[model samples]
Target: IGASAILAENAAILSSGGGDTIDLGFDLNLESPINPATVTDVSEDAIEGLKVVLAASEEAAAAAEASMPQELVDHLDELSVVALKNATNLITTSDDEVDIPPKPEVVPTIATITAPQQEQQSPQTLNADEVSLAPVAFDVDLSESSVKEKTLDEQTPSVRKILKFAIPAIGVWLCGPILSLIDTSAVGVLSGTVQQAALNPAVAVTDYAALLIAFLYTGTTNMVASAQQTDRGTKDMPRTAKMMIGAMRMSTYVGAGLGAFLFVFARPLLRGIIGNDAIGPAVFAAALKYVRIRALGMPAAAVLGSTQAACLGMQDIKSPLYVLGAAAIINFLGDMLFVGHSNPLIGGTAGAAWATVISQYAALAFFIRWLSDKATKTTNEDQPGVINLSDAILEMTSKSDKKDCNGKNRRQSFRNVMDTFKGKALDAKRKRSTLFQNKGVVQNIRESSFGKAIRRRKETTTKSSTDDDDSFSTRGFLKNRFTTRDLFKLPDAETREKFAPYVLPVTSTQVGRVSGYVAMAHVVASSLGTVSMAAQQVIVSIFYCLCPIADSLSLTAQSFVPAIAEKESSMEKSAAMKKMLVNFLKAGAIFGGAMMAAVCGIPMITGFFTPDQAVKELVNSVVPLLLVFFGVHGFVCGTEGMLLGQKDLGFLGKMYAAFFAAVPYIMLGVKRKALAGCKSAGLSSVWTVFIGYQLARCGLWLGRAAKLQRGTYIAAKEQESAAASATTNMSALLAP
Candidate 1:
């Protein structure tokens, strides 16, 4: 019955033209009760309940009509009347079945939904044409989605781990460039562009010379670190020692030989490559002097390089840092004293060169001493010497016969202690002869204060000897030191043969890099003239100085990856490489951003280095291109480092060779363009070529690293499958 009433009301409301109000009523009684004692009583109660429900519904409808607007009330009343008439007609027409009309299709129209208006004499109505008919849409905020991405980045363990190594490595690597910058700054204060321009090419020559032997440093670090990882407990100390010795010998010989060659040919080489036109005759002369003086320190520099590499390989960076710090201080002092006032002893650029030479030799001496000390400490701990004095004292005090307080026994004990102190053995027959012959002397010795002190000291020494396994801890042991001979002993023929394969690849990689720089210098000098070449060098120097930060990050990867690879599964190694690449790319991007900022400020920076307007303008104009070059170059360096870590020397050598081979063509193009009278074919052209080179290097290295990673993963999976198959076959064979 309630369901029928609700349907009737809904139908009425739908049929109403507009503004119809809905009224719902309930006719539940709290006080009235219907008894179920008899069927007649239940019938009477049901009839009464129906009447009450009908009356209550009518009253609710009347109340609803009174509260509603006149139009809505009229429409509702008409709807109700129509519904009632239809019901009456249907009931009267058929006793068993009733015909009903089909319901109308109702469409809702929410009209005139205008914004609220203020009270006025004339109320405004919105026109249908003026109202919007289309559905409204809202814009979405994309920032909501990025929150999860940022959280994931923050939480990544691999990124954090990569940073742990990268940060420190970058810092250490930065020290070299920073020192170079200081040198440049000191040179910049000189009188003219001649001296300053000369510094650029001179430094380049010295750097190239250093690069020729840089393999010793890199090779030593990689091999030694790897060896240390494989032999963690010093079991392979002898082999490592031999390798160290061989590296030192190679460094010194190559360094000394190169130094002599450079010292002799400095003038001709500068004239041939840099040319008399590029560097003024006066500048060339000064540069020649600088190069010769600098050449004198090459042996020391090489030795220091090898020592540093060894220290780095052992993960003992502190020692190298200390040595370099001291060297830098010495160089600074020498610069101030010799170069500041143009001292008569050493003047101008030569003074600076002399300062560097002095510092290099000083550093070399310190490194040698430090290495020797390290070796001696290790050797001493390995083979501890016996403390004879303490042992003899302990032996004499422990003898039961010597415990007596008699004058003769005391004198004998004193004599035995003195013999031990003097590092001599006493025979029993000799002791008896001395004791009998010196009876009066024995009485005098027993009563002396020195004799009593000796007995007391012997008792303490004996007690200490019994308490400790090695009495040397309490009493000093003889110094069993390792000499330079032991520290730098040559490796056996087989060991050298094993390491020989690695030497060439490493050297070639460095040579390829040096060749690129040399080519760049040649291109710049030929096309742009000496002034432009000088400007190019200054800009290049700045870029190279900052680049090591990125290179350091790469070096970190190189140093860390191999060690990680040795211990981890192939999957982990792949992940490590990926993580390292991501870290390197991030570091490169950050460095690039900084360089871009520096590029923007290049005008100001150029002022500090050079007062010449043309040079400053040239540098500033190419700053943007240089920024791109540095950004891409950082990743190239990092990728190279990663490959280096994998010990992919052959691939690196080939890539470097390809780079060197391609550079000449680029230079040729620049030269042809310049000859064709193109205004744009100058420094910008050079930078374009450089940028292209950087891009090519980055792409090649990144692709190679990816390929290596994929290969490692595939190899790991194949090995795992093979292991599983072997295990299954063994299990089948073992079953009954």
Candidate 2:
């Protein structure tokens, strides 16, 4: 929606008339042979010709009209007077200015009509005819439509789209495991002792900032998905994409500011988190030492993640998948090459942080490339004009760059005038010697085969042609090269209206929810026994890694369901929703079951890592319980993403709000009840918090789904009845 709105705004600017203005000299030199009657016919024929041509050649027609001889133009003005008189005579009106001749023509161009220029009022004010017809503004009734009409689709799901979306989502999820494996295998092999030491600190920093990144990145998904879900036609998609790029830039700035602030005040912050004990000091010192290294990645990570989210939102996950996949590989290699050993770029914990920083930048490049590919595919718009980060910063911030008045009235008018009389003069020149209009593959083939063929034939015949013809041809080539389709790459007006309300709120809300959840998670974790907090942290991280898949499903749901609903295809919407629900349920069930298996089965895998009995027991007991809750959470995670995608943030916000309120109580309950022995209580508290929160969230979402289902059913029934009526009407028409 955010992206779409921006595109819509761009389209509005285009609609406001962005192309260059062309001024045609309408010579008032009336020749003595000009008979008013004959002139009228010629002028009328020209006007009618222009109207007909305008159906296809708005620019050329406008140009032609603008350059008409004054004699003919005056004749045309008389025609307007005659038509106005005829209209007044036919229909009775109470107006006083009934039979006056209309205003004189102010032909701006004789070229094709572009989008109508903002008509200029004559400088003389309060002409009776003009005054009577002046527009008046009024307020629309604000009362809600009492008789609720079913939305176009009424909330159906599209399994095909969902599947298309899910495949990439799954692809994105695969990155996590790939990264973990790289960390476990390559990093370990490359520098075992250094890598092991790096692990705890790396985990700690990541954990601390994980929520921040998630919230930041969520902005991308909401904006991108909103852009996709709302049908803004093709032009708006890329414009919204550009706007999102701007927003991402804003987010990066903010993130960088925060990171810098954190780096500067790291000692104080660390002291607060860990206190004055020797372990606290060591942890704080280690964190402070490496924090800046890790923090450098914040802008890149946030921006890259947001870009990927946009890709997902646009229902183009392949780009992000490929980019991230490549990045993960690079990150793995970078970890091995730069973070350990005696190469001396970085060593120990600092080396690990440096590896993360390197990986982030590598990943960022991938995302930028993906965005570029999307832009190229979607529009004929130029590659981002300037790539210097500083230039982007200035462009985004500069007030002068914000408004585009030059592109609107001046340029469009200029184009219109040039295409008028001059257009016919150039018609033979403009006509392609070839038959087919160049588009994509056709254009490619034309370039490769047809161009060569045309050149060869031209060369064979050119023994009779002159250098003047070559120069004219060169001019034509230059004109065509510079003149891409005047389609203007403007977004649709309706698209902005459709998405403006839906997208930004959802994105902002998601950011709030994720950030809140992070803070809430920590708050709850902090109150639990320290061991439980540790257990909780690990479980949450694992959950986050797995959650993306389910979230992918939910995102698919959010995008697909409401879109179907918008079609007013109730039954289809219902079917789509049911399929999504079932898929998500199955996904949740699998995730839950798998988590349980992992948690319960961890002991079997732990022998390779360590032999500490306490660590083994704590991990094994927590894993199974954590997995079940994780599965439950997985279901809702996607559902939440879907809701956000749907731009249904009010419902989503309310649901998460309730869960947040309930989680701490659940934690307190486990803590107070002393459910587990002191040695293992921490792990149990973490387990209880997740299970309780997820279970509650699941119930809330289930209830919301049921209500939406009922609404969809009613809408579907109405649509079916309407469709049947339409069929009957069609039959009656046929009988007549």
Candidate 3:
């Protein structure tokens, strides 16, 4: 329901009279002319044509299993070809720059003309006049309705709520960066310039290694959000709670696998990334040590990332802030104590790595306990364990009066209550018995997927069937321990098949991005030696720490777009969404402008990172280029956020996959300069290349956003105009 729901009411389509109506009927092909949203001077023939079209559309829509979100995202192109855009004419209209006509008046026709209840029945038996009446334009209540009864306001969040989610998210983004910045500052001042230079390669390997599997975080969130909305809009299976469990289990295994892979091949991976002679011996050794040690925390980091993503998808933002805030403090204190002139074995970069590892595991422990507690509470409420099924049934029968309750009504009510209870339970036994063995694949790929949306019950936890059941609390929960068995259960056959579409493209995209970036950073930073490497590290560190500002805004967009677009609006939903988007864009632009001044101020504090004049000058020289990069990235992140929220992941995946092409070209350029012993290629040109890439992304996303935004605006204007003129056209339309 969070994504998209059924529009409950049918809209009245008032005509201006004349519409450039092409032939519209049961059969319309590419060459057939379609009616535009606005019409004037309509003849009876056009009305007849429209009636046919409206009937066809309504029939298709009612029979369509595709929710509005499913229509917008899962079957966009297919809808265009068949003109099912009218299937959701209640919301937004599709087709390039087109508006939709309102559904016409309903009229009775012959028995033979009446449509059958089958999925794809046609009104072929109707006569000409009956043909027009055959396709009824009015609302037809069907037993298996695809859309939700909720309005746009009900389906999409308001700006205030989005900001509520956004503000807390900024802190969540900052926690990881704060740890890195601390390490950079402590290592630069305490361990000296050599160790600082080593950080560029060390961080590239360690951070990106975690990000390489970041699909688990991003993909899980997208799928969960979609599933949640679907559950709200339809009567289908509830998948959100199921997915929550599956995602945690799947992410842990994947994280552990990645950790093992990195630990075993740390040297070769680092070597391949930086090239054979990318950094000097001492720097390489330090980076390798850091990478190997950080690899140990990969599983915890991955699980934490996935856990946080699941919460975000559920629109719970405060939990991450609470958890990460405590983790950040732990990391800060650990860094201060462990780094700078500590035990020789634990000093410098190694100490920083150790500090981060400890904090990550701490955060992980808290999250696990928190999840287990929720299960314990939910389980206790849903079922009091001391009352066995047979005992409960016997007790219920004993309580019933023989004439009224025990005869029939009591048993029927009991069955009904039992079914609802089983549907809502969270324990392993219920999951094993009920959650698996889903029905066959759906025609809509979106429908085939499994999800787990827990609609939390308000039932009192203190209430239980028997006195013995009250004591069943602590000991009952301990059987599962810190982690729920629900999270350990692997995906069954149906799950693996359906879950692939949601996760595979995202993982592929992350793989291309992480590998390409790690390779590109190695090439660019290593070309100019230790001085350049150190300068690059400082610049990157500054950018990433501030990057959360732009990132949080992007995340806000991602969280809102799909569900809003799927909702019915007179442009209000889209307009509200657009307004929210503009606010964030403005925030990004203002933040970017301020950071330009911040870059200039960086020269004043250059001594904090390194005392070396060469490193300082190189960093200062690139401030102008860095300003361009910061400004360009603001728009880049916002537009990409729009696309991400649009669920255009398939296109995004291919776009980034193509982006890997630029890495090889940039690599060759750096290699040529290094071989020729030319120090002329500076960080300035590197920043320019990155700026160009940012511009390319902004341009692409901007065009796509513009097209989609225009479609929605036109849809809104037409809806308002049609509604406003209803009185004007009502007489003319109903004229005998």
Best-matching candidate per TM-score: 1
lDDT of 3 by residue, 1-736 (tens): 0000001111111112222333322232212222222112345565456546545655555445344444343333433322332332322334532232322212211111222321112212222222111111222332211223223434454444445566677887887778777787778778887787677667777777776676677666766676677666343324765666677778777878888888888888778767667458888787777777788888778878877876777666767777788788888887888778556457788888888889998988777776556332434333211112222223232333333323444433433333333223223223322212221221233233332111122222222232224221111121233354555566566655545665656665666567456655766655666677778877777777667766775666665566676556465655655664565566567656766777778889888867899989988988887777677666666666777776677877887777777755775686577658876666766666666666777787778777767777888788778877996799789999
Task: Give the per-residue Cα lDDT of candidate 3 at 324.
Answer: 89
Better of 2 and 3 by TM-score: 3
lDDT of candidates 1 onward, in order: 0.60, 0.49, 0.59
Superposed by TM-score, candidate 1 places the C-alpha of residue 720 at a distance from the truth, in angstroms, of: 0.4
lDDT of 3 at 179: 76
Which regions of candidate 1 fall more than 4 Å away from where they truly are?
1-158, 170-183, 187-193, 234-242, 276-279, 340-345, 374-495, 567-597
Task: Give the least accurate 10-residue stretch of model 2, judged by summed lDDT.
Answer: 471-480
> Model 1 over residues 410-448: C-alpha lDDT tens digits?
324333332232121113223333444466686688669
- Superposed on all Cα atoms, the candidates' RMSDs to the truth, in angstroms, are 40.0, 19.6, 21.3
Q: Estimate each model's TM-score.
A: 0.61, 0.54, 0.59
Task: Score candidate 3 by lDDT.
Answer: 0.59
**Candidate 1, after superposition: displacement of residue 403 in Å?**
24
Model 2 regions lying over 4 Å from their true place: 1-164, 171-210, 213-216, 229-240, 268-280, 341-345, 373-545, 565-583, 586-601, 665-682, 712-736
Report model 3's TM-score to 2 decimal places.
0.59
